[model samples]
Target chain A: MNSVAGTGLARAVGRLRGSGRSAIGRWFVIAVPYFWLALFFLVPFLIVLKIAFSNIQLSMPPVEPIVTWAGDKVFQLRLHFSNFTFVFGDDLYRAAFLNSLQVAGISTLFALLIGYPMAYGIARAPGTWRNILFLLVVLPFFTSFLLRVYAWMGLLGRNGPINGVLLKLGIVAEPLQLLQTDFAVYLGMVYSYLPFMVLPLYTAIEKLDLTLLEAAADLGCRPTKAFFKITLPLTKEGVFAGCLLVFIPAVGEYVIPALLGGPDTLMIGRVVWDEFFGNRDWPVASALAIVLLVILAGFVLLLQKVQAREKEAA
Target chain B: MTGRRSFFVLSAMVFGFAFLYLPILSMIVYSFNASRLVTVWDSAHSPTLAWYVELFHNDQVLDAARLSFRIAAVNATGAVILGTLAAFALERYTRFRGRTLFGLLTTAPMVLPEVITGLSLLLLFVALDQAVGWPSGRDATTITIAHMTFSLAYVVVVVQSRLATVDRSLEEAAMDLGARPWKVFFVITLPLIAPAIASGWVLAFILSWDDIVITSFVSGPGSTTLPQLVFSKVRLGVSPDINALATILVLIVSVGVAILGVYMMRRDRRRARDAQAAFAVIP
Candidate 1:
């Protein structure tokens, strides 16, 4: 009886596997998300590219057509390269782009500086307390990101708590202009994005083998020297990942700058926002977005190449 | 040397946590301040619950919060369904056509800047409206679609990584017991990955709820989300009412996180016990 049942089960399993491996099943599974992304993600990018080459118009859709159907013998194609030319030629756009990179780069550095120590401390802490400490790091991440930025406004405002405390301590005669300045912007960026830096760093540091550090120590290597030689190299990937995560988003950050930055602080993201909503220049906005996209894609491709090289070396 | 190193580690942890949490703690405290001026603390007035009462009564706040919740709920559900399908395709079928493109689509949005995503989607909607006249205007539907597009990437990342670690033999064995492929998936695979799916749903929900940038671009008049409302108000200056709202959000998120942590702890203990029992049987 047992042998008979086993044979029946084997037959059923074989038939099921045969059916599951069918092309229809595979296609059905793959097509859903693929089609959605094509429709939403890929198609939108194509539209943006098309619009970037079109002239701005004060019409319903707000951009002149790049292509139009004329008589059967003659089809008209009008493409405006001026939008790109204007973005490149104008110093305002150029400065905004450069300022964005500078601010994001500095903010990434600050985030790393503050986040590395915190991640390292958590990784090396007592095992039982590690989870709780990690939770503390991630809790604020799940909270409202806007509210967190708003909290900074309250803290940095002239009559806010930070200023109040400083005034009481005679740190300054008056409330220093902490709000609507570059300092406030950097502080907000670092505060908001520190978790993105810490989580990846902690993942790398936690997986680090202690025996290697011990071996270094036994060889009379100083702790800081061991960290530099052994730990840093091993955690290089995590550092890169964390930096990209913070820097990419920080570059295009709209909220932190708009809320905290003064008019002098010009980021590409704010410029794009102003172009689309304030000026209603869809062509210019699309051009700015495309340029930003190209820069980010270049950064991503470079990181991939570096990663591939590292893999080959290993 | 060890003592000094540990002292440094301890101090770093304290200072880091202080920086992370001090702003939030101040916001929560100021919510109850009686003074209308948020930055000032008048000793004569002291703490009060007036803002909380007013927050509950503010029709604009209530309506915006409702719209935000509805959109987030719909987007979270839609994203999970779409994301799970993508995860299964990437995890289970490796040699499909256009696999590389699918993989790129799955992950690209994870790092794509929100400004670009929002702008592109808004443009897409506008173009679609012009060509097809389907979605005539930006509204809750458009906002939900935009949220799902980006949030789907996060859900896929989470679920796909979990699927990578899931054992395959269980499904094979279920099929061996005369279960069909779909039956095996529903009975064995889904249950095994249910935790990951639940966390993905929660993440999608929070992400959708917290969205302001994308929603701002996609949302039309009368479809304002809570974050947009709060942001517009916050731009003027910090209000005690917003502080009240922030405090409530912090409370709700804390409770949700606490529950998830407890569930995870229990699950870990159960797995440990099961492993021990299996080892005993082997012995």
Candidate 2:
């Protein structure tokens, strides 16, 4: 749907068409949101970058200015590499970064494995059923995320039903410690973000031109091969969108880790949270955040470039 | 289509829905538990609503709900306006300079971690208060702004997707009929995209209502929201009161969404019938 860069002729047409009756109205459409985002979103990241470069201090704001007027009109910039150095050098921070990547990657994989079939099913279902199934998938999202995670705690707890059934059926000698484990954290992530994975996949699959698949079948392609050749390639956008939607935020997810994860499952999100609120180390926290942002930014750019290349090829 | 619903797909649907809902069902059951311990089945007493009664009287929760309701309403309204503008710009102003950067800025909040967004925004507020003395002190206003910023991204995503799918030819027809650009939008495009705008507003409101991560950082003294209160209560362990709260929220949302879903389905059917009647297709 995002053509990215249209033909020059098309772009000109778009530009000409965009000129409404009044120029002020056209400008207002773009300017209001443009200024709002630049102020609220872009400016905050710049502030984070500025804070990351400054030394930690004990104050209300908790960081000194990176650039200050020193002496008489001689501007001095004080930059500190200590925060970045400490964050990168520390084993704790290092482990958290690695763990966050590993956990998020694996969770995205599971979410895909589960979400793909469900999305395909829903998208391909009969018309009335399709609407109902889509609503079912999204209904949980209206509920509180925190409570939903909390629901996992109850369902997987020692005294919860999973254990209750297993123990009652004499499947185990004792109740398993399900809560506050890596298993719980992964379960929480997959459960919470499953809708994110399913929604896009459903949209993409629903948009699939079935004639292509029928044409492939008429050409003697097997059902499985037809799916792999036509459906998979055509739905790449949805897959990419779904994976990005799941993976990016999952890396910096604090609630799941803090609630469901064990001490060993130290994600970068929790580390940043602890540094800021626990130790009151704003500089280190900002530095950690910047490092995480850089990693995420790289991933985003690479994914988009790869997708664009594919789009161009097709 | 019937043949398409293979056993594999059916099982996936069953298992997926089961996995999604069993925990919620457990919460509902526990909320009615006659026992204080959430995980335990006070089969004798849990079939009671004592916890629900207790919470309805709790002033802290009630006050937090009131404040959160106000913030969510404000955030939703502001976010819808901003998001509609952003979405229209992205879809219609296809050749604007720096459109890529504008898209990135709008979508980045959706991709960025709440911790980072919260921290960066909190830092911005701190810096602003210190430098300009505008916010003076972090409070509901700051929290509302934070919610607006974060939720607007969702609104943009929702509204933009809908806008991209809208038939521009309808607007063009209006324009050709002596309608101005704004008038064309108001008469044609807005009605077509009303559902998307409504969903976007609901989503923004829900995001604000359920937020704890960002709200924790931006909110100041005496500005605790419902989710924050729930988090503190649930962090220790399972509690029946929280379970009851979950039950109530789920019930309210289920009722609201079900009604909305049915109403939409009925509306669509009626429209289809009207179209058929206009053409005298059946006769």
For every prediction, compared with the true complex, DockQ reads 0.75, 0.62
How high is the TM-score of chain A in model 2?
Answer: 0.89
Candidate number of the best DockQ: 1
Worst 10 residues of 2 chain A by lDDT: A1-10
Clashes of each: 0, 4
The reply for model 1, stretches above 4 Å from the true place, is A1-22, B265-283
Q: Give the per-residue lDDT of model 1 (tens digit) for B67-146.
A: 99999999999999999999999999989778998899989888888889999999999999999996999899999999
Candidate 2, residues B14-41, lDDT tens digits: the string is: 9998988888998998888887767888
lDDT of 1 by residue, A203-278 (tens): 9999999999999999999988998999889998889999999999999999999999988989999999999999
For every candidate, what share of the true interface contacts is present? Answer: 0.78, 0.81
CA lDDT of A19 in candidate 1?
A: 78
